[model samples]
Target chain A: MTLIVWTYIVYIALSVPLTVWVAHTLHQNGRVFLIDSFHHNEQLADSVNHLLVVGFYLINIGYVALALKEGIAPADLRQVLETISRKIGVVMLVLGAMHFFNIFLFSRMRRRALLQRVPPPVPPQAHVPVATQ
Target chain B: MNHLYVLFDAQCELCVRCRNWLAKQPTFVPLSFIALQSTKAERRFPGIDALKPSEQLLVISNEGSVYRGAHAWIMCLWALQNYREYAQRLAHPILLPFARIVCELLSRNRFFLSRALFKQEAQSVARLLAAHCRPPQTLCSNSRASV
Candidate 1:
């Protein structure tokens, strides 16, 4: 039981720093560079990050509250580790997938912007305007 | 007539939207919009290959000189005399390199964002959105140009 609790604690500890770093990157980039697309106040970004952490905490805590028994034993330790690892890994993968999907959608926009600049048709000499006249 | 021409891809929703916004800006400068996709762009500026900026924003000044990519953005900034001080500050010799770094980073994100969320078109609406003209900002105060 102690080991299971510790594993959960280690996961949370590692993710907290990583979450802050990701939020910082998002806050800085969302402003100046992608100006025309979307922007948010810096304060808002900070708030959102805080909110995300809170949400994460609530979910994980709730999960542990229900799943963690007072006496997890040495005999059952191997299965416990595997279960906890899979759950955490799946959560991380889901988060990563969401971000990747978002990025992929934006790249499609760039491609359309590129296509918008294409020429309508080739102009023939006669149909073209006579500059001097 | 002093003409500012923005050559852009018409197929891109983001580009079209940006052009529309810029056209409505109250600069009083006459602008001629050409979808580079239209032969009209080439017909207007002969001897130039139309395909070059068909995928990028091309700004052509009244002087008939063309600017592409970031330089094109610079010309637009030059025209914003009301915001000149901020523009200058952002493009300052000391600050410019950092600004470019920021610009490049933003552009990458923009490209990604457009491809991911909107899914409508490939035109990334990446912008260095200007700080608004206001008395609180130093740039607006420095502007002698008519607001």
Candidate 2:
């Protein structure tokens, strides 16, 4: 029980900051593209970026918390280490999946915005008739 | 009858303008154009209700692939000579998402833009064609001939 408790505390401490850092990186880098997508609407872009960050926090933190319960209590040091590693590994996978999912959603939004400004293609014309010589 | 067939809204001024612009571009593969509401479109794509003639642009490649919306727009760009590189760049990981957004927005607001910007011209595409054509022939006759 003690080992499991310590592992949970350490995981929370490490994972929270890591998630925040990754989210921050995404926010900073993704802002410019979002601005361009929204036709230079900084307000809209910033709002969207903030919303995405908030969602990232909620989903990741929620996952981290929910995944804290160990299936079986660790009986020894070796068991404790194995349990902690397995938990952290799962957290890392969840984080990576969430990150990619967020990117996919943002990419879709950006695509729609960019395409809105494209001019339509020209209609085809038939060959002009030649006057009889 | 070409490598790519583009179907667009004939009544849209914006669509007409785009069609004219596309016609001017130099492309490696020939792109044939037809109005979405035309008999040709009806015959070619018999049962796909998703391709509402006036709503969105459609592109059918020689390989029998149908691309609508952003994909269709990208395919059109890929057919262009000088703009093909830009098309490829636009499809990149960093850019494709934004491109899709732009395409969707433009597709949604095309009619409004047509009315606002190209009202006069779009209202008289036939007249413009007739005047622009050297021999003073009607576009209707030419359209029939093409059909």
Candidate 3:
């Protein structure tokens, strides 16, 4: 393999992990993301979103550089395009599946937190004790 | 039954309030909220030393070992998530050790963080509970049949 080819391979390798990390980080801090998207806590969530996007670009740009170096096609451009299309399709499907799973997980946590949380006891004055006199 | 059982200061109005909130959750199963401060608690389960009972300890009861602290909460959080299978794995024999370590660290800090806010909160809860719960008990003739 040529030096450029090795560099390209390295790029792909680097890209995969970075992609995974960005997704994980985005997920780890996802409450903020959902809150922002829902307009509940837009500023804080968007700020984190922006930070993730920055990190995403840095890593994916590296991936594109690697993809560009693949040089001559595999004899059939259509075949190559088809293969690329298939992989992207799978990637998107996986992303969607994972997102829903996270959402499910998140909703459950919120429920538990809600369950575990006690509303402050109502003040005694709110409900008059029936006259015992 | 969940792998993580948060042994809390049930004597705390805030803690009790949180438990009440957890009790109202619409999950397939309810999270177990134990009041470690109750004398009944000592008689009911593991003994908690009085000096630090209020400090609150979250115990993750699993296959064989118990996890406390931050790791316990993390594992509990994992269980609280909908991926029940994955969460189960977290408590499995292989992963238990790692989760336990993480649970301990986090729990250690969480108590102090919520102490002040919850302290005042609990006072209000206790008063409300006193006003409501006592009346019901007092009126019920203290009879099992009546209750």
- Indicate whether candidate 1 or candidate 3 has the larger DockQ: 3
As for DockQ, the candidate ahead, 2 or 3, is: 3
lDDT of 1 by residue, A1-133 (tens): 4666766665566554554454455445533322322233545544544554455445544544454443443336676567557656655564465445434544543333333333211111112121221
Model 1 alpha-carbon drift over 4 Å, by segment: A1-133, B98-112, B121-147
Off by over 4 Å in 2: A123-133, B1-147
* Clash count, predicted structure 3: 19
TM-score winner between 1 and 2, please give it: 2
Pick by lDDT: which candidate is best?
2
User: Among these predicted structures, which one has the highest DockQ?
Assistant: 3
CA lDDT, candidate 1, residue B62: 54
* Residues A35-129, model 3: lDDT tens digits: 63444666665565566456555555544454444454444545555545544444445545555655665565445444344221111111111
Candidate closer to the true structure by TM-score (higher is better), 1 or 3: 1
Candidate 2 lDDT, A1-133, residue by residue in tens:
4877877777778778878887898899889878987888999999999999899899988988888877776777788778777777887888888888878887877776655444434323222221221
* Fnat of all models, as shown: 0.00, 0.00, 0.00
Q: Where in model 3 is the C-alpha error above 4 Å? A: A1-133, B1-4, B11-18, B26-30, B48-53, B60-64, B81-147
